[model samples]
Structure formats: structure tokens, C-alpha cells
Target: MGKSGQFIKRWKSLSYDGKVIFLKSAVCLLLIKTGLTLLPFLQFRRLFHRITETSTVKEVSPQQIELTVWAVDTAANLLPFELLCLPRALAAKYLLRKVPSLTLEIGIEVNPAKHFEAHAWVENNGTVIMGKWPESVSYHRLWAWK
Candidate 1:
């Protein structure tokens, strides 16, 4: 089977809620990617904050968080263009906006090769919900937003 056919099969295998989550992740990724291109960082963040703000805070299960991570990761992979860590973090934040414990974190590191790198991730109640990798522990946390 072709890549398109495999993609369709994988997509069709998802349950209804999974499908919804995937769609949300894909849309959020597109919006954040575009927003980052067109707007200043601060302005785009403020707009994103306003858009994702929720009146009521709710607690969600670990499984829900896992599902969200899966959705975001899967959506990012399926996109024709790359969606970097910052956009992925922002997208997860949008999905988990109602969760009061959610936080967006940025970390930086200077590699042995003398290259500076940065990463973004989201955490809920002190546990990383997205953007974690084996090297993630090496990064020094620069900032976080709740």
C-alpha cells in the first residue's frame, strides 16, 4: 500500500473521540505555525492566551493527557511540513486549556558541539505531557507560563 493508503487506514482505525482529538491537533498545529510566522511572539502568545482561556477549570485523567499527547505527536508527524517543539507545545496547551495545572515550559542548552538549542514542552501538575525526549533532561529550564 502507498503512504496515503496507510495514512487513511491508520486514521480510520481511530475511535470517534480519537478522530476528534486528531483533527483538533492538526488544526491547532496549522494555526500556531501560521501565527508564529505572521505575528510577533508576544502578540501571538497574547492572542493565543485570549483564545484558549477557559472560565472553568477542570481536572482530567492521566489517560486523557496521554490521548492528547498521542494526538499532537501523531498530527505533527502526519503534516507535510515540520511542526517544531514550540508549536507542538502551544497546540497541547490549547487542547488542555481547561486544565488549571497546565504549564508551558521553555528550556535551553549549549551542546558539546558549541551549538545553542532550545526546546518547548507542556506539563500538567509537574509531569511532562509533551515534547519530552531522551535529551530533554539536559536542557536548563529558561521560562514557563501557566
Candidate 2:
């Protein structure tokens, strides 16, 4: 597995302007997300593989957690109308590729009463980035990592 400290260090090396460029130019993220949702995952990963590499961070594969955060933040800035649905499955799959034997559980639920269903995410390693526990709530899970 890649060293966490090393990953963090690499992530920290980006310049302020460089980060803004990637975030602004991440125009294809919406296409990637939608295409992946429709097409075969491996094919989509091929598209995503490009995205994982399209950052200012050097010496790091597209699979690092920091890279993902970078990419997501950038896309959020660019994709104003996009659903930050949080790309949960994509993140999990990325972790699965990078970290071996990573098993995550997503307790997914939706409530139509509130107009949108909510999804609960939990990593097998017990990381609760989205601990809203939305399993019983009604909010559409745009995409989440469990």
C-alpha cells in the first residue's frame, strides 16, 4: 500500500494557482460520472484513470485519497449544476484498487416523503466522511463511498 504520510506530503506540494487550474478545467467530470453510471465500470475507469492523473500532484497515482479530494473539490467548483452526489462508489472502487482487501459497506435507503432519500456511508476501516446515516432518510444518494 502507498504510505499515507507520503501521499499526504505529495498532496501538499501543489501551488495555489495550479490547484485552481485543474479545478477549473475539470470539465469532463460530469461526462465521466454520467458515462460511468451508464457504461461498463472498467471502461469508465479508463476514463476516470485519466481524471485521477489530471491533477497537479506529481509522484502519486490517481488512487490516493488526497488526489480524490483534490479532483472532487475541483469538479465541484467547475460543475456548479452538478450533483456532488459525493461519488461514493467511485471513491470506494478507487480505494479498492489502491488499498488491498478494503471492504466497505453502504447502508442505502430512501424516503420519498421528504422528496429525496438519504444514504449512509461507512468504510470498512470505519471512516465516516458522510455519517449522516441517511439510510432511513429520503435523499437521493448522488453517489457515495461507504
**Against the true structure, whose TM-score is highest?**
1
**Model 1 stretches with alpha carbons more than 4 Å out:** 1-10, 110-113, 135-137
Which digits, one per residue and each the tens of the lDDT, describe model 1 over residues 8-106?
886888889878988999999998999999999999989998998889888878888888888898889889998989999999999988999999999
TM-score of each: 0.87, 0.40
Give RMSD to native, each candidate: 2.3, 10.1
Candidate lDDT scores, in order, read: 0.87, 0.46
How do the residues 44-102 of candidate 2 rate in per-residue lDDT, one tens digit apiece? Answer: 75676664443232343333444544555445444556544335434433433344323
What's the lDDT for candidate 1? 0.87
lDDT of 1 at 23: 95
lDDT of 1 at 138: 80
Q: Let me know the TM-score candidate 1 reaches against the reference structure.
A: 0.87
